[model samples]
Target chain A: MASIDIEAEIRAEPPARAPVQRVTLLAALSWFAAAAILLLWQDLTFQPLVRELALIWGAVGVALVALGLAGSRLGRVGRWTALRAPWLLAIGIGMAVWTVLTAKTGLLPQPFFPTPQALLEVFIYDWPKILHSASFSVWLLAKGFFFGALAGFAIGVGMGWSRAVSYWATPLLRYIGPLPATAWLPLAFFIFPTSGSASVFLIAFSTAFPVAVLTWSGIASVNRDYYEIARTLGASPLFLITRVAIPAALPHVFVGLFMGLSTSFAVLVVAEMLGVEAGLGWYLQWAQGWAAYANMYAALFVMAAMCSGLITLLFRIRDRVLVWQKGVVRW
Target chain B: MVASALKTVPQAAGTEINIQTVSHHFDLEGAPLPVLDDITFDIEPGSFVALLGPSGCGKSTLLRLIAGLDHPAQGQIQVAGEKVADPDPSRILVFQDPTLFPWRNVRANVALGLEAQGTLKSEGHRVDEAIRLVGLTGFDKAYPHQLSGGMAQRVALARALVNRPNVLLLDEPLGKLDSLTRMTMQTELVRLWQQSGLTAVLVTHDVEEALYLAQRVIVFGPRPARIVADLQVDLPYPRHRGDPRLAELRHQALGHLGLDSSW
Candidate 1:
């Protein structure tokens, strides 16, 4: 019988796996191809204007490659690049190629499809107006979101916890919840003193419905065992609701908040178009009337970035509060 | 630290438990299904009693009744001459699953009872002591998911122990653990019971576990559970697992449950 050498086995090193290189190579190739197209391809004879954007794109591609090479020493940033290099590269190249095809080559329609250069020009020239409109929209969104979330949360807990509340609220929710906020525009305008207040109401009404429904469902689905355990620990009904039920239902509450946020943004845009003097929605309509499609596109881009940024902020809050669900949930 | 911390908290003197003609039923699809039928028993203070029975024998239901999680449908249960009305921190039930709040870390989970009672500020030291007692000293910051099965159950034990309950009602607490962990935990349970001087009523289907831990074993029949046999093991503390007396008692308990002793 042969005796196994445990010491030697413990001292031995396992084989090292190779790093992912093919995707990195492909990502680099795509970036280079995009840069080459931007540099060599001439269609509309607009040289100086497109050159600046192309230079920026080319610099980004170079930086990405440099980051990938120095990834071993870069720690988290390097690892993140290694993981997301393919998608990042694809997006960069796809946007560049699409801009070249539509804006320079005129393969797509003009005015409707504004060049990236025109969009940039709009940002440079009309930045002050855009910023003013953005701030106004943000203020409206904040007021509406805060009040809607607060009221919805309270109503949801009540509806879920008490039979009497549910009995009355369920039917009301059923009747009012499914109706779109825009549908209530005519009534809201008459009901509220100002267009701004009417807009706020529309946004709030849209946001509250989803939040209330989700909160009700979330609270209803909390494990009975937790309640029993809390009760055994001498917890009051208030303690049970606040500490036990609320915390347990947080994951569901977050889902509700996310839905509410999206709907609120949609309502905000439409409500702003309802004779509101200042907001991204009002700006978009003004830009469209003047046939400045570049400004419209720029506004759309800003709205997209802002909405996504808000959602990201909410996700960060959820991750911090619901620490127990760390590895279980991911975007 | 353990000794001083233990001394600081008032020791929960075991309270006598009395059940008078207790019966319970569950409403399954609007039809009443009988669970426990006319069960009566008395548990002395500071004694360890094992409720040994077959699966679904309503032993857990009986334990829940004693814990005041539910009221007996027919009869009444009293603890130290006072009628059991609602669940109190004085009587803590440790379920089969560890049931530690996944949101709270080990230390916070242990502190839950005190926090609920609004005495957390004064009795906060007990949480650390309980964690130490359960041998989870280094895992104070660990979440329930981060801990192993045995560790989670240990945290659950610590959570209940922190409250210093006079009556610890265990409903198959070690039923989910691996054999090795279960055996080690059984020893730990006996040690905690001996040290604390609290009345313990354990519900388990494991014959060897009942034989190893309890001074007295109460056996119950299936379905509408009723006490079939009650036997006392006069063996001393730190009883050996391989002792002939334990094997004899195991045989007796198994025979009462209508199972063959020759496994």
Candidate 2:
């Protein structure tokens, strides 16, 4: 009797989300069409991953149809599904086009644009090597970024607070801050004991400049009234800097961090390709040397995913810290 | 249950403020822009006095000096018996804007003075007490952006009141509020002042507001402000806005401000 009542309640709930939206169906149809094209029509012997990809697409299409039939059971996720339906359809259509152009015909030629299966094959066969290089790059990046951001924050705060520091630092920052980290690569490699250290220096230099510039700007632009309020409230100089200045300027610091991360990524790739023996960047160059374009594409994929993942993580931290600044800005 | 550690402090609740022929100027593109011109007055301890003036007349600057956030270029200003050279927790100034820190919630904002003084650990309950005193009992977790203007201003008052300042210097604290909210806040201000027994010095241009709230209204002239008149409001506490004596005092203050209506 209880089970029957639960089923009745489930069935009785009205659709609060869009009622099995047509866009979801369109998305499903597009994905299925991509799968069908991959399965039914091919100009070459398909790799295992290619067939697997088709199966995944077909499964995804079926899942979307089921989700749409489930109405508002998932609430926010259901609404998101409706909104993202266009993206889903576009991705499916894009995949179908990629398949038709690459393995299916010589319309776009070969080697330059590796077939979808060829790219996936590199992922399957070269998983261990790819993982090793990626982890190494991340470890190097983490070290450089952590120290660079710390140094930048301290420098920025000092420059903002004291006239003597600002006067001394401003000229130095102007001279040293804007030079490309890659420009220092050859010199840095010669100066440092190891390639690892050289790459770290390159990444660190790239990360620190933007972070320092933005952090200094942030601290300098803090409202004067904030200082007055804190002063009258018995705040010491230390209190003024830590409690008043830092918290007020954090939003700007986060913005600096975002710019720093991107610049560091660029420097990391350049440094690894030129100096370091192993990393995704080095792997990319190695694959190209051998004319293994599929392997190169695979390394590129890993790099993109890593870069975007780190950025998303930064955004998450910013969201948590700046909860008070609701509706101010979102990256 | 935690005991009130704040009670252990020996600072008195109200102290006298003395302004002695204070003159000050600002550098506007290499030229001297006089704001306060030989301003001289004294505020009685534990009473609300308003410095009534026209816009840009330097009454706000005078309040800033009394709070020790700024110094007089020429003459001296004293509090209790000592010269006020730097800002101290004993005299908290509420600015025209609430100036509540955007990063802090109401509780933390009110607790700022205690935190800065290294007393928050023992005297944290005073923060809650101060928030409640200003009628913001449940908004302790609300950020400054989450609050309305009047509520933010109340948080500012709580932030000041939490410090247990002997002298509360208000530089047009209620000037930004809507008329309806302003009316309610004026009543609350009187109640807060009367209950706390703090020396309250408010700076405002509103003739009626000055007449309504202050025990004495010191009217000032235009820029490089000089005292034109110091009219005493001999009205009782909780004075009505529509009181005839308030209207009479308003006329006198307006006359000094050079806005006396011929009709």
Question: Best-fitting candidate, measured by TM-score?
Answer: 2
Runs of candidate 1 exceeding 4 Å displacement: A1-103, A328-331, B1-10, B260-263
Which residue pairs in model 2 clash with each other? none
Best by lDDT: 2
Q: lDDT of all predictions, in order shown?
A: 0.85, 0.86
Best DockQ among the predictions, by candidate number:
2
Distance from true position, residue A18, model 1, in Å? 15
| Model 2 TM-score, 2 decimals | 0.92
B77-111 per-residue lDDT for model 1 (tens digits): 99988999999998999999988888889999999
TM-score of chain A of each: 0.85, 0.90
- The true-versus-predicted C-alpha distance at residue A221 of model 1, in Å, is 1.5
Candidate 1: residue pairs that collide: none
Task: For residue A301, give model 2's deviation from the true position in Å.
Answer: 1.4
- In terms of TM-score, how similar is model 1 to the real structure? 0.89
Provide the lDDT at B185 for model 1.
99
- Over the full model, what C-alpha lDDT does candidate 2 score relative to the true structure? 0.86
Q: What is the C-alpha RMSD of each candidate to the true structure, in Å?
A: 6.3, 5.5
Question: Under CAPRI classification, how is model 1 graded?
Answer: medium
